[model samples]
Target chain A: MRQNRTAWFFLSPSLIILFIVGLVPFFYILYVGFFDWNAFSLQKGMHYAGLENYRRLVFDQPFINSLLLTFRFAVYAILVQLVIGYVLANLLATDFPGKWFFRVIHTIPLMVAPLAVGATWRLLTIPGFGPVPFYLDRWFDFEYSISANASQAFWTTVIMDVWHWTPFVTLTMLAGLTALPREPLEQALVDGANRLQVFWYVKVPLLRPIILSTVFIRLMDALRTVDEVWMLTGGGPAAATRYTGLYIWRIVFPKTDYGYGSAMSLLTLYFTILISWLLYTAIGQQRRGER
Target chain B: MKKLITLVVLLAVVSGFGLTANAQDDNWWATAAAPYAGVTLHGVSESTPPSNYAADVLAPQFEALTGIKVELEPTSWDQMYDKAIKDMEAGSGIYDFVYIEQDIVFSYLAQDYLVDLTQALVDHPELAAPDFNFDDFTTFIDDFKNAEGHVFGVPMEAFVKIYLYRTDLFGDPEIQAAFEAEYGYPLAPAATHQQHEDIAKFFTEYGEENDLDLWGTTVQAASGHSSSFYEFFESIAPTFGVYNWGINEENWKATVENGGQMNSDAAKEALAWWVSLLQYAPPESTASTWDEVAATFAAGRAAQGWVYGENTAWIASDPDRSQVVGQVGVAIPPLAEGVMEAAEAGTGYVGYYDGGAFGIPHSSKNIEATLLWLQFIGQPSVQPEWAAAGSRIVHDATFDDPLVVEMDAQTNGYYTLLQEQGYLFKGAPAHPFHAQVRSVVEPFIWQAIVGEITAAEALDQAAAAADEEMARLGYGQ
Candidate 1:
């Protein structure tokens, strides 16, 4: 009982902070989710909107469109990041002169702020006047302006996410490779396996956990993407780039519709939680089977 | 020891004189602010030049005179609105004063978020400084007053959107001859939509043939941002004979079917005209904002376009800021043939009058101290300095100030245009539903801008969405 009391006492401060900052806000959002509350309106002016907000969310064209776009963006961005990270990790895995310098240089994109990346890309991608476009047309016979069309802007944001985060995946894979047992690789080589076969059969299986973690984290962060979209497109070309997170921000901040926004936010949270659970379970089962 | 004593005495006398000199400046209202000297009055405002001046210059002077400390927080536009509205709505009393833009005043007033300055003045006459003369303000003061003539805030900054063109391009004899031959009109300040279109087309062609890095004009249309919507409805629509951005006067219905002209034929034509100009504009036009638009003109990329007046002074006169400083020309924004007629009927405005004011929110903890602060900012002596910094003038007298006069000469009477033609323009219509309606309607404008939908289809869809939104808000029942 004394030990339990001491443990409880040690946990009390964190518990209070969590309750105040996390659980309190969640419950309040839950409460507001049932009503129609505008910030500038009076309490008397507020109405019990009930499940109307949620019901409308199901039918809300913009919200549904944004969700679909966000999903597509996440899928493409993760795929590109995984492929690029794998290539970079493989290249860096070899011992060479100036290896550390090259690795650091490759990670420079990841170090940049998202807004800076977006703004820089926006300038570079200007169709005629911008240097990137100007040179591409002159040297490579390629011409495209992302801001000129919706679909184009969507793809550009996906490309931007890939460019910004591929280094994270590369470093994660590098860490996994660094920790790999050399015995399995040597044995695979003695068994007459080629370099490719040894890497595929031995290194790949051991790096599964790290790969899964990197993919899942990037997916979640991409789904809630806001800053890049804001700085680059402002969710423009008719909101083609408005991911779920930016849409929620538009609702809560500018529109001041806290009730509807809360409902949408909670629904988003539910989706995110479900995805996380499924991924965690699936990965855990795979690990157990391998063991 | 004697030398050290003499040095200390000399230092004391100099320091004392410096204190007295500073004290005399704010002494006019020092006694009233004496009790509040130690107290800190907090405020939040967007990081505009006027607000920065208030933070860097006015705060220390006020603090020294009254003993009240002032801490002014300057932040980005979105954060400024968010902090002020959230604090006011939650009744947190975190801010003693807040910046209120003319565009958002309708909503602010509707929520009763601000104290009635007229009533505050009556309630505490001692808080009102004698030099805080309300009449010293220009007609723009109406932007902060309710319909009942109750002043809710004090005007701080006011500017208009005006027509800016390149004199170098417009005055070239060979280019003028080519324009006349091609369009059957002498190239001058555009008076009709056709002329503006012709000018844009001529400039783009001229730039292409000569291998010059030039375009017809810069359009402040970002396909996905609120900036595009503002340019379309506020700046472009008014020129096409659409009044009050097409919201019906009597019923506030935004749809054509409901008697509002928000999606009227005129508005459609206006959108079409605006969208067509994109082809002649630089490729970055689709992503262009007010900042981009100003930069484009400054770089001499655009021959002419309607630009916000805040950038007018610096862009036209400061060679460091503009490559085309000597070649910049100012005029009224181009109007459709019948626009002047509609504008004269008081049913429409020539352009947007962009300005903001400072008001004491009802949730303020220090209303009396804040009231004095508001009056201090309103004095005529402070207007010229604020005007020079922000490129906006709140007092009529500031227009005649020597500094303003020099700027007027440099920019070819842009200030004079504001003084003479300002009466022709007004801020966004006073509607509490401004932000709400704008959020729902702007996507359609973007759709049109990006070519996803025709101008007519975009407006039609926007009108329906607005009708539904208004109904959902319990309006127009």
Candidate 2:
């Protein structure tokens, strides 16, 4: 009891800050979700909306569209990142000169701010004056603009997400690759397994745990992409890129309808929690199988 | 004898300090603000030229005179609204003064977030500055007032959106000959909507054939941004005779079923016309806001477009900022044959009267001090410099201010149009659910632009959504 009290006493400052910064606003949002409230209106005050907001959101087609878009974007972005990251990790796993320099270079995009990254991409993909389209036309003789078309806007954002975050996946996989036990691979080789077979059967299974954890982290981030899309297409080309996160932002700020926005956000939170639990269960099941 | 000499020296030093203090000509601000001296006032505004000038130039001058500090936070539009609204919503008084866009004042009033400046000025008449003539502010001030005619905010910047074209291109004899031959009319300032369309088509073809990196017009139709939606509803729609963007004033209805004209034939034609112009605009136009449009015109890419007058001084005359500085010309935006008459009858508007005001929030503890600051900024003496910096004039006297007169000449008489025809333009419709309505309509407009839906379909969906939103907000039940 004394140790528990001491532990809590030491944690009290962090607990207070965490409650203020993280938990309090979330709970406030949860509370606000239950009422019909406008963010800027105080005279009308909050009307006890009960489940109307939730019902409206659940039946909202645009809301459902945004959810599907976000899910697809996350899946696409994660898969692309994983493939690129795996290829780079494999290359780095082999002995090479100045390998650390290449690794540092790969990780540079991770250091810069996401907003800046988005801005850079916005400028680069500009149709007439920007270097990306300019070079594409001048060198490759291609006539295209990523922002002018809805599908291109969606795909361009996915590409941008892939570019900015693939480095993280690469580094995570690199760590896993370096920490892999060499005994299994050597034994497999002695057992007359080819490099491809050894990698597929031994290395991949050993790396599954790391791969799952890295993917889970990236899935969360990809599911909540707001800044890049805002700077790039602004959820544009006909609301084609209006992901769920951007939709929530539009509601909370532009619409200034806190009740509907909070309710929608609470649903998003539930989905996030659900995904986390599912991933954790999958990881637990894989671990048991490995054991 | 030594003690007596020291006393005499101390007396001389004290008197010298008093003389220096008297020489500081603060015009009584130092005296009035003496009590609040050292107290800091926080304000937030969007990062526009006028707001920046107020923050960088006027703020320091006021601070130096009054000994009170001003911390002005200039940020992006979305973040600025979020910060100001959140502060007012929480009643935390994070900002003593908030820059209120003309469109959002109704909602703010409905929320009771603003201090009643009429009462503040009356109660603290002694603190108001001499040159702060509330009456001299143009009709733009009406946008910042309540239905009871009580003023809530001090107008800072006000101007009409005007049609800007490339003067050099318009004057080129060879181009004129080609335009006449192609369109059977002499190339001149477009007076009708059809003429504007013809000019856009001519210049687009002209640029393509000549390969001069030019387009016909710059459209602020960035499908993803609120700016595009605003340009369509406020600047484009009314010009096509779709008044109030199809809101029924009598019952606040926005659906065709309720007698609203959002999906009317006229409005659908207007939307189709706007989307049709996209082919003539630069390819990036589908992803453009006012900022991009202005930049494109400044870079000599677009021949003509409806541009905000606040950009006139810099884009048309400031050589340091604009590449086609001397080539820019301004005229009243083209309207349908009857738009001007309808606008006069209070059924529509010819163009946008865009500006903003600074209002003290009710949550402010230093309302008195903030009022003094606002009045100081509102003084007629400060109008010219602010106008020169921002290309927007709120005071009547500013029309004749020497610097403004010079810019009026420099921009080929852009401000002349403002001084003469500013009355034709209108601000956003006064609605308490301004943000909510826009949120409903913007995406549909975007989809219309991108061909996912026809203009009629988009408006039909938008009208239904707006009606639902308004009803949900407890209005027009």
Candidate 3:
């Protein structure tokens, strides 16, 4: 009982800080979400909105479109990043000349700030001045205008995300691969399995947990992506890239509709939590099956 | 005893000379700001030329004269507004002075976010400087007044968006001959919508045939940005004889069926005309804001464009910033029939008279110090140099200043046009729900710009959305 009291005393400061900084604001926002509020309106203050904000959310086409777009973007980005990262991880597993240099270069994009990456890509893709458009026009006569083409803008954002995060995925998979026991792979090779078969059957299964966790992390991070995409296209080309994060920002900041923004943000938080729980459950179940 | 008396006499004579020196000139700031000396005034403004001048030039001068340090943070337009509004809403007193843009001032006033300068002067006469006279400012200052004619902000800068064209292209004999032969009209500044279209087409083809890196015009048509909405409504729609975002002020409805012109035939026509200009604009036009449009014009990539007047002086005179220096010409925007008449009769306007004013927020901790800073910047003495540097003239006296007259000559009579014809232009309407209505309406405009919807369809949807949003905001029931 004394030891337990000592532990509680030690943890009290963090618990109090968390309550003040984190939980207090969270609960306050949750409370505010049920009211019609504009911070600028001194007279009106916060009216009792009941479930009106939530009801309006169901009919908010922009919000719906943004949520759908973010999901689509996350799925596409994760699938692409996983494939590319796994391939890079596999290639880096082999002993090669100047491997460290290539690895360092590959990891450079990961180290760059998202805003800087977005800015660099913007400089590279600007219509007349940017090298991407200049070279594309010179070589293939293809008109590469992200601002004009919605598909191009969306895909470019995906590509930028891939560039930014593929390194992280690769490193995670590589760590998993290096830690795998050599016995199963050696036995599989001796049992008449080809290299492709060995990789598909042995290496992939061993890396499954790492892959799932990587995907889970990347998925959550991608859903909340705003800075890079904002700097790149500002969720433009007719809201082609207006993901849920950017949409909530538009509501909260520019529109100053705090109630709707809070409600939508809470909905987004719930969605992310649900997704993470599903992934966590799947990983746990897989571990149990392995045992 | 004799030496001590001589020393006292000498000291008295020196003190008398010092007093006379102090009383020689009108140093009102030193006296007015004496009580507030040593107080640091925090301000936030957009990083425009005028605001930069306030921070870089005027702040130091004000500090030197009054011993009150001014810390002005110049930032991007959106960020500035966000920070200022957030600070005021929180009642944090973070910003002693905030840039109240013409469009957003009504919202600030509605929220009681700013300290009333006129009232402050009335309450504390000691804080009012002799050099600071509100009547010295042009009618643009009227936009910053409350319902009772009490001033809220000191007008820092005000300029209209004007039509800018390349004089070289318009004056070249070969190009003029070709344009006449192709379009059956002499090449000059466009005075009508059809003429503007013809000029755009002619210049585009002219560039294509000559293999020149040039387009016909510049368009602020970013498919997902508020700048596009502003361009269409404030600059383009007015030329089509639509005003006040086409919402009927009486009913606060934006649809034609509801007696609002937001979705009227004229506005649709205006949108169609603006969107159609995409082909003639530089490829980057689709991604452009007012900044990029000015850049396009400065690079001599566009033959003619509706450019904000704040960029006029630099684009026409500063060789380092503009390739079209000495070749840029300023003119009125091409208008539809009877639009000019309506503008002249004071019932409507041509293009946006864009500007902002510095106001002490209600939450300011150092209101008196900020008021002194505001009065210091508002004096007619500071207007000439500022106008010369920024191409923004807010005071009536600034128009006749020698420095501005020279700059007017350099910018091809831009100041002359602004002084003579500025009254025809107007700022945004006095709507407290300005941003709320814009947020709802701009997406449809963006959709139209990106070809997801037709002009008619976009405005139809936009008008309906605007009316719905306005009603939700309790503007009209």
Which interface RMSD values do the candidates have, in the order shown? Answer: 2.4, 2.2, 1.9
Q: How much lDDT does each candidate structure score?
A: 0.85, 0.87, 0.91
Q: Pick by DockQ: which candidate is best?
A: 3
Candidate 3 residue-wise lDDT, B1-477, digit = tens: 999999999999999988876554246677777788899999999888889999999999889899999999999777898899899988999999999999999998898888889989999898888778999999999999998999999999899999999999999999999889988889999999888889888888888988998999889998878999999999999999999999998988999999999999999999999999999999888888887889999999999989988889889888988899899999999999898999999998989999999999888999888888899899888899999888999899889989999999988899999999998999998888888889889999988988999999999999999998888777768
Candidate 3 CAPRI classification by DockQ: medium
In order, what DockQ does each candidate have?
0.46, 0.51, 0.61
Distance (Å) between predicted and true CA of A15, model 2? 3.6
What's the lDDT for residue B399 in model 1? 96
Sort candidate 2 into its docking category.
Answer: medium
Chain A TM-score of prediction number 2 = 0.95
lDDT, model 3, position A40? 46
> Model 1 over residues B1-477: C-alpha lDDT tens digits?
999999999999999988886566457578898878788999999876678888999888778778888899998777798899889888999999999989999899988899999988999887878778778889888888888888998987789888899988889898889899988879997877788888998899999999998999889888877778888888889988786767775776889989988889899999999999998998888888777788889988999998888778778777887888778888888887777766777767888888889999999999999998888889887777667666789998999999888888778888898999887777998777778888889888888888889999999998888777766665665
Give model 1 RMSD, 1 decimal.
5.7
Native contacts kept, each candidate: 0.64, 0.62, 0.58
Model 1 ranges with Cα > 4 A deviation: A40-45, A108-113, A116-130, B1-25, B38-40, B56-74
Backbone clash numbers for all candidates listed: 3, 0, 0
Give the DockQ (C-alpha) for candidate 1. 0.46
